[model samples]
Target: MDFFLMVISGAFSFYWVFLFTTHTYLLLILSQLTYTDQIIPFELSTHPKHCLSVGTRSRQVRVPRVLAIEGPGEANARAERTWRGRVPSERQVNARSLPQRDSLHRYEFTHPQMGTVFRLVMYAESETQAQAAATQAFAAVDSLNASMSDYLPDSELSRLCNQSGNGQSVEVSEDLWQILKLSDRFSRQSGGAFDATVGPLTRLWRRARNLKEMPDSARIEEARQMVGFQNISFKKGQKIELKKTGMRLDLGGIAQGYAADRCLKILRQNGIRRALADAGGDIALGDAPPGETGWTIEIPASQSKEVTSSHLLTSLRLANCGITTSGATFRYLEAGGKRYSHIVDPRTGWGMTHRVLVTVQAPDATTADAWATAISVLGESGWKKLKRKHRRLKAWLTETPITAH
Candidate 1:
């Protein structure tokens, strides 16, 4: 949502390179060019954090805390000179050479219900341009949140929820309508594995979680009766309606990804070539600069100190792609001495029990988000199904369970 660009000096022996300064304590080195006798040779970094940002509308709505830059030694020196306006001492040069900053132009905001932060980074042509872009990005995010959030009484989602049991057709904003249609398409493709018509089920579970007690089997079955994609109908140029009373719709599963996709479009339309947008766990990457393979992404590993071996993602890059992760790491309830995650299978009316996490890569955020949820529910079988149906979709699953001695 926010943009930034660094014009570092071409790498040369003893050459001075300048990196831009930001408010966040991170630097993003877009590229490093080695200038030997004025001949420029470039190398790409295999790090996702190094690549441009990507994601949907919600990402642009939030601000980030860190931004890092990468460059050769000469470029770093030049960056220091540009920001500090002086030749750097050895210590300053060494410290600045690595991606460290005291501040950045990016901004961050927290979501009340989602319990996570959203970030937007920008590289504008000038200070004025940067501010304008940031302002627009923030406004866009507010508009999106107002439209999609269920917590807001007037939000499109909230209005729909209120009319759930009335069998009344609701007119949704164009943006929200598109997301629902996409969810329908994905649900069919995944054999009802990705349904947005699980509002009743999700709400029932939320209440059960708050009470710290499992819902009665009959109650769950009653809620399940209202949870089916087939229950909601939509037509082009028309309002969407629930076929049966008590049927509801919730877009939590795919809304964040849709927001990411929308934000990416806005950034690209504004002539941003490289950026990253993250809405919760959904991330989208803009184009890698010329000669760059892709953005390098870090898949957090079992230990906080270590991530999956970098070698595992040696060639992984998200050039114009979307990445989303779904896991039961949080938001669960305990019953009968067993833990149940917040994510539920629409068809089964049960919370996901296996597979601790699932990360998916796809052409778009919506697909990535829905597939991540569906596959996590499907477990190994879903993985196989996805591999057979769509080769372009790549996935990873992690599981951890308690063992009794």
Candidate 2:
């Protein structure tokens, strides 16, 4: 499990504001005077891209691509990668370690996107700018989530899934199209370990988790028939189609990381040079935080209560890269003395049975998030082969060390 505690202003109000600098709608903060002026204020600039005309007036803003989605814990049942830090539990955020009245102010906000708490941390000279920047960054993630979330029945990805088994190519947004292409590329590269078409299997295991039992073999097989990344058809002209009916696309593994990357972009564009956008476990760091050299993180070997600090598998200082850790610690199904991870292997129509915790660091959050799960599915041997093939990809896997040969 990952823990992040961000200190932010307590004053806030709830309202949905849709603002845009590009074709995608950005989730803007709505308020007055102090909050509103700093965030999405109406102003006129020569840059048409940044200004939206309203009642013969234009508001100044930056032009950039955005995605949209509802707040967290408000939608259908989706695993949400379980990395996005939710409302920080008492143990997650340590208040004593934090600095007081620092030169660089830090701001945090919780978005209901991905069904988890997305904590955006930004360092700026003033509290107003930090709050504004964090708001925009989270809005960027909300936009991406709106487009990629399978939980939303009306989402772009869900609509695409509805067009499945039609044997006809349907046009998709550039963002959705790009994500599907990456999904296909990684799915092939990982040899079915990282599959976007594992929606059926994920749902099955989710049920098993609730029941604390294993799924029936027959139902598993039925879902398996609809689970295959190879069944997706990506043709020319940015069109895609599911090869079969009953096939669902779940971006649980990669979407959050991609959203994190986009959030980083939004932060940089807003002149925020140092920040950390932690989309659950998928963390994208933009430079170091203020005076710090790099962001510090710990990678543990297992979730076992007995595992101590000395048992740490890896500790990292990360900057300008994406870090993701995948394990069965938080969510799993246990039955017949066997514990199953929520990460379903699409090829086998089952969950990851091995007690493996895999962490990967890559140039981007998307790759790191997807590869972490893929490496976990591959286990030790697959990781060795993959490491040899992708030299830049860093991974650490700790498997069942209880039993000796």
Candidate 3:
């Protein structure tokens, strides 16, 4: 659930399609051209069966009827000539119409592994080629998800978690190794603000929220014992080991961003230079659309005091970069009048209660995603410290106004 959705091009363009969770919904704005920035809160059915397909609908293309040719070589030559230039009016007698040459072909589909709808809008000569490229990109995303997801017991990450204990080591896939390395680096860089070893605390908070009861302080402290980046070790040849027995890895924070980057890479491999990969709102951009500097991303600000809902705080036109937002505006638990965000502070083993939204922009999606989660937990003081160290990192923060009873 997001308080605000990221607007790609064309108002509610390619990225607007999302699969809602049972407890969460989305705020979708209709065409900005027509509505003047009005938002509609639409609750989607949580049933796995329901999926929304968005983006430009394809127009029917009428292929030109070709006459019989004598030989294969002659037919090939004639086909090449036909594609290069216009055929005579007599040859065009049966030609109907072709898709607009300059039009962009967008293919939207739900990722099988992630269970989230992703849009791949590409500039291609034909719909067939666009669909092919989009399919390849989704396949890339699925491969990454299959390896990184902790939800699946047999996933590579889970396999590593199960093998790690009592100073034991286990060799992992290259993908897992890369993500683990990143998690370790960010954990150290953020002063424990970002940690993949926070899985135990995450599970505890998740269970507590599910039962609508806050976890006891004693239990949270106990879980903290099993969590620490220093407790985990990574070696060459993609080997990883958790020094503690109960340590686990949760890539929820940065895995999607990595996957988005991979999807963009795959699209480029298929000759799609201009594309956008919105992996559940963790966006990675390729070259911008034709004639534009970059893709416009709408970052939602807090709802105005006069308004009842959220709107775009600002818009960023970005090219060849990644952007991610972390906030408690959605998917938070309210217990005893305190709002706890889903993000947990690894150091304290507790969910963050501060109502702050943090958006981070980075050279890549993985970095952006991890930093966004880390900065959200760090709050203003911690973020200032981090910014002092990293001058190039760009961020935006919006805090909810605290009200008195």
Candidate 4:
């Protein structure tokens, strides 16, 4: 499980909320503060280190230690009024309570979806509005989960998988279509590094996780045959076709990031600008709190050794974007004295055996999520090759284990 430690503006208690994603879990940090006109108290989550070890976990790609955002001069009315969130890096989020009130209350609400907890911390004037916005946002998540989850047998994604190799294209919901497009784009950009079609291998790997042994080499090869971005073709009008009979589309890596983004959108639509949506550990932030310039994200500084890793907390303050970290720290498999991350490399049907954390920041969580997975596979140098192409994104990496103090 991923550990999230929080220390807010005033007196705050450390709380650990567990969210299960894939075979991994996330420890969430939440704090309660008085909802007042004064600058809204920012709820902070302490990351184990300044760098995040990202892997196929987010099924993601790019940025460095610090990811920049749209500056005040670069932002417009809507953009200025909007804010961004962060991942497992030094990105910060500053916020205010609320201007005149009348929005989602300064409260946190959560629900389980996509194999993790979807959390929303927002502000509003009336409890009624807060409840209403939460209800709508959670409802959207539930609906989206039904559309994307591979675990659900009758989910839209499952239905499409069932149609694999039928030589027929299936029309998807708008939401699913959007995610598919992203999956395709990243898959191409990362050179098959971040593929949603890694479902076959993931299924086999899941068994490996439970059985405590690596899947048979032959089985891995068999599953790998069905895993490739080329196997799934996206047609116009939201039609998706799986050319392979046993292809499975695994969106585990990036779905939550997209969900986090949606959560922020819903919150904004409900008149809540100062908000943050933590989908599992993937973060989606909103406009600065009531008075602050941006949200502050503190990631502990890290020093990696051959066998262990240690960290000191480091903080960065910024606004308006998405962030996610993928690593094998909490979720991985140990077989034959080897540690395997839960993130399955779409290229090779094997979980990464290294100890690397990848934290990616981008304009949205979807990009951050997918790219984190890609970067985990690509390494820092690989990202640096294409870093100039994605100027708005930043990534950070740290390898080894976290030595507890």
* Tens digits of per-residue lDDT for model 4, 1-405: 123332351223322222234224221221112212122222233321112222212211231111123332122222222223322122223333222222223566778777777777676767777788889999988898999999999999999999999999999999999998889999998888799999998899888889888889999999999988988788887899999999999999889999888888998898877777878668877776543466666444474534332353555554678877777777788988889988888888889887788877788888989998998887777788978888888887875322110
Query: Can you tell me which runs of candidate 1 are displaced by over 4 Å?
Result: 1-115, 165-167, 289-292, 300-315, 400-405
RMSD for each of the candidates: 15.8, 23.1, 21.6, 20.5
Cα-based TM-score, every candidate: 0.69, 0.70, 0.71, 0.72
Report the Cα lDDT for residue 213, model 2. Answer: 80
| Lowest summed lDDT window (length 10), candidate 4 | 56-65
What would the per-residue lDDT of candidate 2 be over residues 1-405, giving only the tens digit for each residue?
122222222222111122233223222222122232222222233332211110112233453211111222121112121123222222222322221223554555556679666656666777778777778877777788889998899999889889888887789989898888899999999999999999988988898899888899999999999988889887888889898988889999999888888888888888776776777667777776543456665566665646344555554666888877786766898888888999988889989888787778899889999998898788889878767778778887764121100
Off by over 4 Å in 4: 1-105, 305-310, 399-405
lDDT of 1 at 149: 76
In candidate 2, how many Å is residue 17 off?
77
Estimate, for each residue in 1-405, the C-alpha lDDT of model 1 and write its tens digit. 122222232343224222223322233322221111111222343222343222222212221222123331113323323332233334343422444432222223333223344454443344565555545655676777787776576887777767765767878888878888888888888888788888778888899899999988888889899888887778556588777777667788887777777666777677654555567767666665322355666453342223323323223656688888786766799999788889988998888777467778899877898888888778877668567778889886754211100
Number of the candidate with higher lDDT, 1 or 2? 2
User: 114-142 in candidate 3: lDDT tens per residue?
Assistant: 65556555555567777787788777777
Instruction: Give the Cα-based TM-score of candidate 3 against the true structure.
Output: 0.71
- How many angstroms is residue 253 displaced in model 3 relative to the true structure, after the best TM-score fit? 0.7
**Regions of model 2 farther than 4 Å from truth:** 1-103, 301-314, 399-405
lDDT of each: 0.62, 0.69, 0.69, 0.71
